[model samples]
Structures are given as structure tokens and as C-alpha cells.
Target: MQDKQLNKDEIAQLTEADWKQRLTSDEYHVMREKGTERPFTGVYNDIDDKGVYRCKGCGASLFNSDNKFDAGCGWPSFDQGVDNAAIDEHVDDSLGMRRTEVTCSNCGAHLGHVFPDGPRETTGMRYCINSVSIDLDKNEH
Candidate 1:
């Protein structure tokens, strides 16, 4: 298990082979290649556990269970990240559609996309993250 997040310098020093060796095929596809898992097929989709979601690539704290909600969009949905620095958003124009892509700030791993169609009572933003991009660190509260 990863105990610490990688710094920018460390992240920059990693090679493609280093990433492939660190992650499984699926994780590499989704995180390194900017691929997306099938909707409703993600392990974290239905899980409602109390924990922190850390970046699978660098173990950077990304999301809290407190910000999680059932967006019914198939992936694990969070209203917000753990902090502003934990996630970085970029303009994704792939798939012929304009969308905002979210990545782990610590390692530049592709997490998923964020949309505006979230619960209005909260942040009104849906962080549709891929299950393979994160690992849950369950904590008892």
C-alpha cells in the first residue's frame, strides 16, 4: 500500500514503464491512457462506506466519503474533492464532446470527469470518478 503521495518532481521523473509496473492493466488503461470504465461496472459505484478516496497512482488524498452521493450516473460521485490542491481540472475535448477532466494533482493520473448535473442542494457538481483510479481508505468515525 502506498503510504505517501508523490511530489511533482517525483511524478515527473516516472516513466511509462514505471507506471505500468505500478498499476494493473485496467488501472493503467483508465488512469494513464485516459480511458473510462463502463458505467455501473465500477466497484465503488454502489459502495457507501465511510473513508477517504486516495489516488491510486500516487496515494494523494482525493475525496472524503462525506462528499459522496448517489448521482446514479454509474461511477462513484463526489460533490467535491478533499481540497482544491488534491484535484486539477482540465478542458477535455475528447470523444467529440466538451467536458472537464479531473486528474490527481499529485501524479497527473486521469481520474474521470466532472459535470454540472449534480445535486443542487450541495455543490451542484458531479465528480464522476473511475473506481480503478482510487482506493478507499476506510476509517471509523
Candidate 2:
């Protein structure tokens, strides 16, 4: 089933309590608290189906199945987002390292981090995302 997308205005109105109520414990931890799921433990880590991945927090379209690739990184790796505006990237300086953190643009929910190492033949970018942060809508066609 396709989920309804929320606009920025709608997302802005959501309180932390609302998010806590809407998301599961894992989803709340990953998406709202900026936590990472254990490597290889995510539902989408080994998924090879055709679909669009949406933000679990707000149902905003984030990654297309065509952009997903197995990076052997124990996560759902994508070369790019569904579009430039589909994700918001920020510089993360925690864990004594610097990395680009990717988030849901509409809801400002943490998704994961992006790395420079990816398939050279493609965009050469790897968006390592947490499965709890997103929901996949399998395409019928």
C-alpha cells in the first residue's frame, strides 16, 4: 500500500509526542533519536525487490529501487535518492569522525549516513540507510 505524503507544513506541526505515538520503538529510536540499527539486522538489508522507499516518519519518498545496490555494508545502500530534494544531507561530526548524515527532508527525521565509496560505475555515492527509518512500497509492475 502507498502511504500518504505529508508536506513540510504538516510535518512542522507534529510534536515529539505525536511522533512517539506514531512510530514504533525501533522506528522512533532510529528516525527520531538519530540512532542506528545493528548491521545486517535491518529488514531491507537483503531485500532485492522493486519499490520506492519512503520515510517511516512521514512517508516522504526517499529512495527508488533502481538506485539501491548491494554495497555489502549491512544496510540498504542506495547510490542516490529519488530526487535531489527527496533527502537532506548534513555533516555529522559525532563518533570522532566526519560523515554526511542523510535525513528525511520533509520531516527532518534521521535516516542514515552517506559515504563516498560506492559503485564507481554509478554515482559513486552510498547512502547507507536504516531499515527502521523507512518503509518500502513494492511496485506491482
Candidate 3:
């Protein structure tokens, strides 16, 4: 990948079939195609399961269940990440709106978005992530 953005057609043609072959159906849809999965349908939504969540695309450690929080917005929300450098934030202005998009810093797999409207006690931010974008490490904590 280059520092310059790849056009959709360019991105769509960049060995996507290779990625499809490498990823599960759901993961291919979300990560390679930017498809959003329905909220509350994810395994992590109400999970008490112990683990570290990693980027499905590249196995990069992202979040722990300990950092998971119920944002009441139907998505598995977290006020924090496994670490400050665990992910990267990008500017997204699609759909006539502006938002900050988040992704795994290691692999650039889209996790979801971050918002300023968060609990004031900590970072005051919410990283609303897609369950399909992550793979649980299962009790690494």
C-alpha cells in the first residue's frame, strides 16, 4: 500500500480474491469490502468471555475483555484499547458527515469508529468496533 489513497476500483482489484481465500466469509465482507455487520449480533456484545481481541486480518493485539464496556448503543464498545499504540485513527467524511475511523495499527484492518461522546471518567472516547474484525485470544489476561 502507498501513502496515497487507493481508488475504490484500485482497492477492489488489489488481490482481493487472495484475501477472500485467506479470510472467512464474514471477515472478507467486513475487512476487505467495508461492510458493516448488524449490531448486537456479534459474539462480543454481552460476552464475559476472557481474552485479548486481535485484528482478524493480521493477528495484531487490540483490546481485552477487561476494557470492554456496554455503550448501550448495541455495539461492543470500549473506552480504551489494549494500548495507546494498538490502533490508528483516520478522518472519515463519508455520507455527508464527519467521523473518526479506527483500524488496527499493525495491519490496517478496519475495526470501526471512535467518537468524542464517551464517559468522562477516562479517555472520554468510545471505540465502536466490529466483532467480525476481531479474533479473541482467549484469556491472555
Candidate 4:
């Protein structure tokens, strides 16, 4: 894993070839091609480890494990991202449905989608993320 966080400037300079070289087939599919992963198959789906989930494409911190929750939606869900700047949401009108697509702000890598149906006590937002688009940086403390 990259110990240093990648900045947006560095990410912007990366091309498709660089992305392909940096990410695996599965990662490139989800993070680069904006494809979804099979539900309940992501490595982080059931994990409750404490740490930050960094973008697989740019090593930028996107989600904190403390915000993660089991939405039972097959993918790893989070109430929110690390902060407002960590992720960017866009309108996705694919599959004849209107949804909010989430992407890493640093690298513009597709992480997943956001839904209004989540824990009501919290943000009431479920950030359904693809595991292949992230890497867990477990907290040592």
C-alpha cells in the first residue's frame, strides 16, 4: 500500500494506462470503468476493522471504519465519508433509475452509490461502496 496520500494533482496526471498498471483487473473495472461489484462478495463487506479506507486508485482516504455499518445491502456501507471533500457525488441515471454515484474526490475513481435509506439515527445515508475500489489501512492504535 502507498504510505503517502496521493493528491488530486498527481491523480489528474494519471492516464488510463497508468490506472491499468496501478490497479488490478477487478479494481480497474470498478474504480476506472465505473462498474459495480457483486453484492456480498467484497472483502470489506463484513469487516468491522478500525481504520480508514483509502481509494485503491489514488491512495486517498475516503471512508473511516468508524462510520461503516451493516446496511445489509450486500456492499460495504458507510454513514459518511472521511469528510465532505473526500468524496464527490454525481447523478447517475443508468439502468433507468436515478441514483447518486459516489467517487473518490482525489482520483475520480468510482467507489459506489449513495442512498437515502440508512440508519435513521445517523445520517440516514448509505454509502454503498465497492471493495475493489478501496484498501483498508487498519489503525494500529
Question: Over the stretch 16-72, how does candidate 1's per-residue lDDT look in tens digits?
Answer: 999999999999999999999999999999999998999999988999999999988
> How far in Å is the alpha carbon of 57 misplaced in model 1?
0.2
Judge candidate 4 at residue 119 and give its lDDT. Answer: 88
What are the Cα lDDT values of the candidates?
0.93, 0.90, 0.78, 0.91
Report residue 36 deviation for candidate 2 (angstroms).
0.2
Worst 10 residues of 1 by lDDT: 1-10
Candidate 2 lDDT over 4-100, as tens digits, reads: 8888788888999999988999989998889999999999999989989998888888999989999998999999999999999999999999999
Counting clashing residue pairs in each candidate, in order, gives 0, 0, 1, 0
* Lowest lDDT 10-residue stretch of candidate 4: 1-10
Residue 48 local lDDT, model 4: 92
104-138 per-residue lDDT for model 4 (tens digits):
88889999999999889999999999999988998
lDDT of 4 at 61: 86
Off by over 4 Å in 3: 1-14
Report how far residue 122 has shifted in candidate 1, in Å: 0.9
Off by over 4 Å in 4: none
